[model samples]
Target: MTNPYKSYLSIGEKLDKSKFILATFHLQSENQPPARNASASDAGGFDQTAGGVAAESSVGTWTDVSLQEKILWENLRGRVVELDEKASIIRIAYPLELFEPGNIPQFLSSIAGNVFGLSEVSALRLMDIELPEVYVRSFPGPFLGIDGIRKITGISDRPFLGSIIKPKLGLSAQEHIAASMEVYDSGIDLVKDDENLTSQTFNNFYTRVDEGTKRMKEAGYLKEGRQKIYAYNITASYEEMLKRAEYVVDRGGNCLMMDVLTAGFASVCGIRNRNFGKIIHAHRAMHAAFTRSKQYGISMLVIAKLARLAGVDSLHTGLLPAVFTRDTCLTW
Candidate 1:
């Protein structure tokens, strides 16, 4: 009996770095004995499970394909470039043509989506991904990057201090303003809406922007001419986010905070591309659900990279750092 998806395994294939993405996954197999129907030479545990990942993620189904389908699969399937048995790591080289350029959501949906649910592996994590230079540059990253943030706050050579308006909820819009003003008066440089506080009746979105922005201006101008950032949360439906952003700009707010995970990457990109002259701050509120486990789901580093590609200026800490680069592997 021949292996059904053996063609997906190409152990020593040399990929064009520019035309492919290298993804590293921490893989685990059920490690059971070979089925009775398998060939006598079958090492039907880890190798087959690893190959299943490439097949499912790319083009192959569990069932065998016809000769005609094999011709089409030749160029489309993700090729397993390296598999380490002891360390339980598999590296796959995926063709750039397999992904939609400049679309993070679709790219993730393809490689990181369906493969996680497969029964062959009990534990899996999307440990790391290396991007081609062209793919990295395809999206407009960071509307107001580090220099812009430094320029905004008039701070150099030191970290800017900030806080959230706590008693995170049940604070009326006016009370929320008072609490934020206290933080600003104490010389904190940034204040943001907590991730869960958005558009609630007790603290309505419009009032928060209208009054909060006014108070920020007073606090900023009066306190040694320092600029205070009101990173107002605009996480909502895409259309609603735009509407809220307009309201923030109209109210003279200098920054916007988004629960990027909750807002969705596409919406984050939508807000960034609008370029309403405000810095975008990312809050990964529910990221732990996807990032905490060392053996499951996507890594926080991957999330940060996606956030940067989606155009966030500053991100929540655990947490927060710039995207992974070639030098990053050295540090890891």
Candidate 2:
């Protein structure tokens, strides 16, 4: 029988079906052949002719296919649009019906699952995605965007100045509070806990938020009507993360920070749904493992987009080289 994917040979045909995801895959030389077949099967590679009378009677024609089989095949398969041997890139059009609107976990599993483990692929990266308008509109993105952040921090003319607390782990709760107050007094607009700085033994999350905000108010920072944002790192288990965020909000904290990569995009989206009325600062703590390689893993740009879609107010983009290592720079 004719290849089912042959029906969607042109860009116009793919575009006509509005609900679909456009995914780009990078394939290494060792697995190119199988990767091609796997990608074809990933979306719709099932042999309609196998174990049936249609296999023997209409082996070379598409006419014998039933309407139900055609519809099912189309819904299950991803259409291959471009495959470049020299450059090693494969672009596939995944049906929008394959994903559920507003569900990131399911979306990830559909577009990003299992393909990496295929024996044919030595390395595979999900470089980019072209999400349809309906899918894009289904999620509530950053509530506080760049303009909103600028308005909240009262810094519109230039870049907002911020710093991470040094010696990331050992500081006591009081020490953390002192350092934050000093930064706020020094005219820094924001201060954030380092990505690894969670509820450590010495620097408890609640104590830091409680004393830190108190010190900010006492420093006359709030008295002058200028807001100084303290992004308390709330990266923990799903339940613990929510509790930490709630604690920050209850104590009048202005911002919440999370290691978006380690905590998972779903966690960030969950936090956004809480409507806590605080800025969400996203730290790409462990993104390098999946984003550093040029020929393997995803890109930081895609990660940033996902974070924004998950509703982060401010995302670390590696603008400051001094803050990130050489390896981290590669991911950015």
Candidate 3:
């Protein structure tokens, strides 16, 4: 009638097992931290920044262990209990002997998703406790992914042609609205304000959303019956973001955009989780710092999947070969 974990522990104790492997995960940020390059020569990987790779080191038995929970778990076994409430994290441990010496990487890989429902740090700690090959590859992408986007844009035969309302400098709401008209008329399906050009001087967000979307709708009606959505970027404190979103909805705007990087994961997820009808476009302005690394940081794929889970209707995966930017080969 005892717990399965308890049963596993009793067996380990009866056999005099000294080392138990623990996996801990740290969920400090609602969004995935950006990735950064860290030379392998350094012991602490990439100094764990907001959007940087975590430092990897051996802990336990070795007093200088970069992570100590591993060692503690080795001694505690089933005696240890864990919990993860929210933005915090959780950690889980197993008998180190449960894994093969050269297979720590596989073990972490197999349990990364589960990890006894622990924190990201807890997962990392497990690997630190008993080194893994560090295969941070995330889940298989979206289901109704690029094809779905193509179908929505009615551009399944080609990439979704889009552009931004440039001149991130001084521009009145009227002027911006004029630009939206041109972009839509010229055949662009999507148009967004520059990340820096939020509801600011001269071009207030409300004025811009009201007038700009009005112009976009006008253009769609006159052009080819296609509404080039002006996804007003609603990046702000949650309350303000929600207010803006509601405002956009009230104004007949069907698409909403948020700089997921700037707004934070909880904000994006909060909006998406609401299941709003707007197409959630993710603008990846500050993502370069995390995804630019070829060696250390996490991949954009992880971010994309998380966004999808958060409920983003669409996202800027990256430029394609058909465009000027390099074909990063992200989500279609």
Candidate 4:
């Protein structure tokens, strides 16, 4: 019997020099019927009607290929790189030229598009992406990386100490100021609002910023030559988010916190592009909903890379003895 994946292997080999996307998918037996007539050589052929094979015209038969079929076979088709029957894992390679530069929405739609809804797969997960240099260089990376962060905070030695205000919400503006005062007095180099704490009736965002900074100055924390960073959560509507960021900066607050996942990457880019001159602390709240499932959705590593590209000064990697599982924590 001929190898069913011959076409896929050939396509992959031909595109070896070009940029391509590497995606790992987990296949479940219940979703995919066993292949019957298909051999190893023909297995990689896209033929949805054929058991376990993706439906499409063969790349080898160019004469019979239609315009759509030709475009798909040549530019959009996913070439099988590896298949493990025992583990039910399949790795596919897709040419990178198919994707638009610096656009995550379009990039994801192409790489992780309709493949998931295939009745042949019970669950699908994008485990990793080997982005090419050209693609990686297309996006603007972190504006304030580790060195820049250290320069602003003036901590040359050891890891900088930071904390999140506990009891995430329901604190009034005065209460927030009092809490911040205690935290600063305790010598924590940085303090931030919880991801869920934004402009609310109980604690208005502007009031918190005004009160927090005023107390920080009056307590002599700013005069003592110690620059205590306060990252007020600015997660809100697109307009409100930017407004909150501006308010913080106007009030002498040097840092702004954003629930990056909830606020969306585009909003982050907007803030960064505005040249606000305030540090951006990225909060990964609500990330686990999609990221936690191993058999479906994107991974946190991919999210982190995207966040860095969006220009966050710092991001939450995870904390010890916390909610995240051991494996999940390690992955971050």
TM-score of 3: 0.56
- Expressed as tens digits, the lDDT of each residue in 1-332 for candidate 2 is 33343454333343544666777767663523321333444332211111111111112132345544766755555665566646766666776776778888777766666555544456667788788788888787888788877776677889888887788889999997788788877888889999899998898888888898788777755432367888999999999999999998887778899999899989999999899878999999888888878777778777877787888888876653685666566434
Candidates arranged by lDDT, highest first: 1, 2, 4, 3
**Can you write out model 4's per-residue Cα lDDT over 167-226, one digit (the tens) per residue?**
778889898779878887887888889888888899998889989889877876554235
Better of 1 and 2 by TM-score: 1
Query: What CA RMSD would you report for each candidate?
Result: 4.4, 6.6, 13.3, 4.6
Q: TM-score of every model?
A: 0.90, 0.83, 0.56, 0.82
* Winner of 3 and 4 under TM-score: 4
- Predict model 4's lDDT versus the native: 0.69
> lDDT value for candidate 3?
0.52
Clashes of each: 0, 4, 22, 12
User: After superposing candidate 3, which stretches have Cα over 4 Å from the reference?
Assistant: 1-156, 221-225, 320-332
The best candidate in terms of lDDT? 1
Q: How high is the lDDT of residue 35 in model 4? A: 43
